[model samples]
Target: MALPRTAPSSWMQSLDLPSQLFETGSTDYELYEEDDEFVLSVELPGFDPEEITASWDDGVLDIAAEHDDQQRGERRTYHRRFRFPKSVADEEITAEYTNGILEVRLPVEEAVVSGREIEIES
Candidate 1:
């Protein structure tokens, strides 16, 4: 499934809600799979390579970034969430930032039936 982008900044104004004075930026992402590993490509410009944060919960992956441009008097915060099909190996995950693009490799685990039979009425 393709990731969805947030509505335009004017959406709230069109709804007659109070304007959110500050500006909010959007991050774009692409998903793909290769050799049992899911590859996520995220575009985050003007952000330091070390400042982005990412976490996985259940099957959802959350990514957030903050960039402060003092020269232009602008600050931007971006966030995006993605839900993969199965659980990922957190320890084996790897991410790299290059040329404003963040590439992450999430190794997919094999499906295993998780449960145990318990004897009752002893």
Candidate 2:
């Protein structure tokens, strides 16, 4: 999902209104699993690395940023959360911000599937 510079009201979102009404500066992001790890990359321009914060808690990944432009008397904030289907090695999670992009790597724990495949009868 893309992150907007500012989000619409929760009530508006719950109503399922047209997204055009909520249009704003968009921050592109991608999430995928590769080589037993989940990788997430987000585009966040005009923000310094010191202003961004990433946190992982209880299977959820939270990314947030705040920029206060004292000269322009403007403030920008961003926040998003993601959850993984499989267990993640939170302790080993790592993130890096460079060139207006933030990337997070989450190591997925080994999973054991123990269900037999069902036979379909025509």
Candidate 3:
């Protein structure tokens, strides 16, 4: 006889490897709001420093990393996109990775007008 399925007691508790610790399509991360900055922490195991990259455009933050073992014929990748708050300085965002963890610091700044009035030529 088959046992009935039961709901998980926790949001992030599971027996599966890797998947239990992070989402399937992207890496796992935690967001924190501080008095001066917004912190974003991401877990990227088995990735090298050169393989990682980060960028921001139009208030959207994008992070990605990839590694390949040619002899082992294995490839691993992580990609995540975060829409930063309008109150934060998207252009000033910075990131650092250590011990398989990536921490991004985004200092909040007053919103400034990025547009300027243009004069039309006759």
Candidate 4:
């Protein structure tokens, strides 16, 4: 008789070894409203500004960074699991990195106004 096979636990399935061993962990992020735009700040240490990439699509904002192979030598192993939320936008977004921090500015779209005015019947 063969023993039954069991599914892996949620925690076990979410682990990414490559990211944990070599890749740095995901940076902390903060979002705030600024005037007519939303500002997002992410704390990324030991990361180059040119190595980061960010984009938004289908209500999800994707952020990814890969260390330079030539500059940093061979890719190191990682053991981390990170899941970033996607942005819900049809157009592409832009990001900037500076002082070990990444700042993203998103412009708020103006709300549409309906032309129909309700009249009171006395």
Candidate 5:
């Protein structure tokens, strides 16, 4: 005999089930410093370039996207903010979206680490 389908538990129903289940893994975005610039690449599969926006304020870079499908009655949104370790030239920042991937490049100002290296105990 087959088991009958039942409703979810009260606690489960109260959770953001869809988001938790459908969200991408932590590896969906990559950030790194290279060639005097901070590079960020994020995978946003279902959104179009027109629906995506990127902005820099102070030391934070904000990336957001929204998509709406009237026929399917569905809406999706993505938002993320990143703070760079070094000063960024906000005016030189640039972004590009292609092949469902959004790439943002932030030119970092002259930032050199000046600290003493601590010896580790064997």
Candidate 6:
């Protein structure tokens, strides 16, 4: 007999609300996975590499930046909020910015696996 399929969890359904409320920036990102590390690339336009800041607290990565003087003037204005998950701890991540892009490298922790089998007696 085939097992029954279950519906998606409530947490998955809740995500749709926030996505409708906030629009992501024009920037894009790519994640690369290697044997030992994960590399994250974020594209940031109209920002100087020196002005960008990135931090990882708990398990969420935070990236923010201000436009350079050449791009900012009295007529310019912006209002937006970007919320990150709480899993990213501040001490577990490092980042760098270059060429109007921010790159974050996160090292994956090794998992410990035990090779053992147990039989349950009814």
Whole-model Cα lDDT of every candidate shown, in order: 0.83, 0.89, 0.82, 0.59, 0.86, 0.58
Predicted candidate 4 versus true structure: per-residue lDDT over 28-88, tens digit per residue: 7788766656677877766776667776655455666666567758552212222334332
- How do the predictions measure up, each by TM-score? 0.68, 0.71, 0.67, 0.56, 0.71, 0.52
- Number of clashes recorded per candidate: 0, 0, 0, 22, 0, 10
Residue by residue across 1-122, what tens digits does model 6's lDDT show? 75436443444455666553344443367777655666787877566666667655456566766653655442322222233332233355567777756777777665567799899999
lDDT of 6 at 113: 75
- Cand. 6 TM to true fold: 0.52
Over 4 Å off, model 3: 1-27, 111-122
User: Which clashing pairs does model 2 show?
Assistant: none
TM-score of 4: 0.56
Model 2 per-residue lDDT tens digits across residues 6-58:
55565467778897666556547999999999999999899999999999889
lDDT tens digits, residue span 1-122, model 3? 75436544333345555554554455379988887898999999889889999888777779999999899999998888998755677677889999999899999897577888999999
Off by over 4 Å in 4: 1-27, 68-94
In candidate 1, position 33 carries an lDDT of 92
Pitting candidate 2 against candidate 3, the one with the higher lDDT is 2
**Pairs with backbone N, CA or C atoms under 3 Å apart (clashes), candidate 5:** none
How well is each residue in 6-87 modelled by candidate 1, as lDDT tens digits?
5656455556655555346633788999998999999998799877998888888889999888899999998889888777
Q: Which ranges in model 6 have alpha carbons more than 4 Å from their true place?
A: 1-27, 68-92, 114-122
Whole-structure CA lDDT of model 5:
0.86
lDDT tens digits by residue: candidate 5, 1-122: 85436544444555658655544444779998899999999999989899999998889999999999999999999998988877998899999998999999999887677999999999
